[model samples]
Structure formats: C-alpha cells, structure tokens
Target: MSRFGDPEWGRRRGGRLTPPEGLGVLTALIGKQLRARLGSPAAPPARPDLDLALPDSRLVQDALDHCAAECAPDIVAHSIRCYAWGVLLADLRDIRFDREALATAALLHDIELGRTERRDRFACLCFACAGAEGARIFLEARAASPDRVTRVCDAIARHLNPDVPLKPYAESHLLNAAAALDVVGAGARALDPADRARVLATWPRGDFRRTMQAAMRREQAAAPNTRAGLLMQLGFGGLIARAPFGDTL
Candidate 1:
C-alpha cells in the first residue's frame, strides 16, 4: 500500500461515466457553478472572526493531534485549511455556530478517507458515515457531551452533501462549502481574496490534487453507491484538475 494506505490509489479509475443517480445533484451543482460565477458584492462582509485562530480547547488539540497522526500529511493540512475556509464561510453569512464543534468536525471530517481495507465496519462504510463514526468513537471515548458529539459527527457525516441547509446545520453547510472550495475552488470568490491567499499560505496545498483524487477514488471503490461514487459519476476528476490551487501554496 502507498503511504496514502491504498494500493489502487495510483491508478486512474472512472473511465466511464455512470450518468448521475438523479438530476438533483446535477441541478444543485449547476446552481453552485452559477453562484460561484456571480459578481462579488461591492463590499466584503464584515467578519472579525476571520482573524481568530482555531479553537484552543483540549478537544480541539486532541482532534488535530489525532487527525495528524491518523491521516496523510497533506490530508491533515487540507483538513486544517478546511476549518479556516469553513470559518470564513460562516462569517460571510453571519452564521451562529459553536467554534469547538466546527473546529473538531473540520479537522476530523476526512480522517477515515482512503479506507479500502474492508477489514471492519468503519473501513467498509460509506465515505461520510465512516469518518463520522470514527469521530463519534473518538469523542465518546473522551467523555464528550452527547450534544457536542452529535454536532461534530453530524457535521462530518454531511460535509459531502452540497445542499445542506444553513439555518440549523451551519456546521455541516460550512464544512461542505469549505471542502468544495479547497478541492475544486467552487466558492473561493465568496470570501475576500486576500484572506483566501492567507489561508493557503498558512496551510499550503502539497500534492493535494494527486492525493485527494486518489482518496476520492478509493472511497468510490469502497462504496460505489455513496455520494463519493456519485461525485465521480459527476466528473470529479475534471473538477479536481480544474481546481485553482496548485501542488503548493
């Protein structure tokens, strides 16, 4: 297995398209493209939270340390950058959310990615559910409150769902937006360009395109009926290639 933990990860797979399972994702994605292309506001949204760092609680540090140890280096960096991007998106919309939940969820969202082992339920599970369960176990072991544990796991589980509502699921909604921005540059223009540049400079992408592409394929292969598979059917490789970020910052 590669350091990424999958042997097939080096090979290209999705040679034939499966026509999306339905038109809902397609419609949502098209709407996303249009929204991303829309004109920027005359003035940027006021977001003092953009200056704040990731939550400093012990739970947050535990999450960062565990994720860094469990996942690939670039994947960990991507997760941290996901937190920053999600924070920016939350501030852009003035979404009231728990920073601790958001921070822990963002950092742990992809911790179970690239699992083709099928050696256990977690490895065999769908993309989002697997990671969410892993997070659930981690938080539960630490005696996290039931509500906080639910919040983090739910956010991680729904991070791949592009159309998650913002009213009560701000954590999930922001995570999805952040992941899309980092992976495909889908909504990069929604935030201030300077802040975007800063986020990248801090946690620069490093061969992320290659690793993330391979990871997505690993998930699709492990669970072809999942949203991961749906993303591939929707031309995910093309999206990754088209992302604005290069192999480095």
Candidate 2:
C-alpha cells in the first residue's frame, strides 16, 4: 500500500502536530500579519499565473461538477478559490508542480466534508484522510493517471498540517497554504490585495465561516483524537473567526 493509504502512518506526524507546532500556529499567523503590515515579504504573492478561471481540462471540470453537486454553495466557492490561490502561490514561489494535480487536490481536499450531516463518514479517521480516499476513488473512476492520483490524494491527506513543506510536496504545500489562508488567514498577506479581491469577488465567500465552523465542530465532536478534532478543541473556531478577512466577509 502507498504510505498515504496507511491511516496510522499518516496520523503519526503529518496531520498530528507536535505540541510546539500546535502552539506555534497562531503565533506564526500573527507574525505573518505583523510582517506584512511592517513591509516585509513574509511569503510569496498569490498572484495568478493566468486569468482566474478553471483550467481548461476535462478532469478539472469533472471535479468541479462533482464538488458542486455534492457540496454547499459556500463550500464549492471555497474549493474554487483554493484552486485560484494554489496556482497563484505556486507560480509566484517558482515551485515546479503539476497544475492539474494541484487543482484537483485543492477542489477535493474537503470531499468527505460535504455531507457532515452524516458524521459517521469520518467518525474514526481524519476528515483529510477520508477526503483523500474519496478523491482517489473519484479520480480513478475517471481514469486519472496513477502518479496524478497519488499526488492528488497525498495532497488532500496532508493539507490539514499547520505547515506543509514545499520540497517534495509542492502541490500539498500550495493547497495547504491556500486552504489555510481561506480558513484561518495563514498567508493572507502573501496574496496580492487586488488579486485576492478578484478571487473573492468571483467566487463569493457566502456563509463560509458558519458552514466551515459547523463542519469543524462536528468533526471535533466525532473524532476528538484526530489532529483536526484536537485543534478544534484548542479553540480553532476562534482562530477562524479572527481571520483578517472575517470582518469583511
């Protein structure tokens, strides 16, 4: 089995955080905010490499169609915006990555999250791992290449990390950064203001905060032992509520 398929192995570190890392997340986000305000390039610009639109490919379109059909409008918008931010961050950071893989990972990282009403879907595993498995089955049914499938699923599995390393996991790193920025304002400053505006204007934030907060709370209630559940226990909702964009959205 691929290492990613091993839930125990994945939980060992990627999703499970060291206490220091867990504690450092809020501090790091505040630091990023302060640096951006004080005229420091704390991270790369989330400026798009292309116009803000879906990549012209059958696979991406299929993923979007599936996501939209299954997810809430807010969740669908969040996933699309994640794709926009992921590509933009990748280009600005000079990271060599597969665009399609990044987009697929971004759009489906929260696949298992759609039907949170059925909490049993992820009662025993991290939502990220469950999402990754769901994404894999969906992609394989569409005959996505093995390497692409592996990378996309691996990225979904890892996006819950406080920080994903860019070396061997560029796509994962970008997806995590974008997802975090949308949810907790992790790299809010790195994204160019104008570009960020464009993405949000196109996708619309809707009731994302409430939707995602509910999802997180449900996950925490169902799997308190998982990293996400543990983090939610550590006041993760407050962090999401306090994101810089929260005021406007």
Q: What are the lDDT figures for the candidates, one per model?
A: 0.75, 0.74
The TM-score of predicted model 2 comes to 0.82
Residue pairs whose backbone atoms clash in candidate 2:
none
Poorly placed runs, candidate 1 (over 4 Å): 1-22, 39-49
- Among these predictions, the greatest lDDT belongs to 1
**lDDT tens digits, residues 75-111, model 1?**
9999999999888887777788888889999899888
- Angstrom error of the Cα, residue 244, model 1: value is 1.1
- For residue 27, give model 1's deviation from the true position in Å: 3.0
Worst lDDT run of 10 residues, candidate 2, spans 1-10
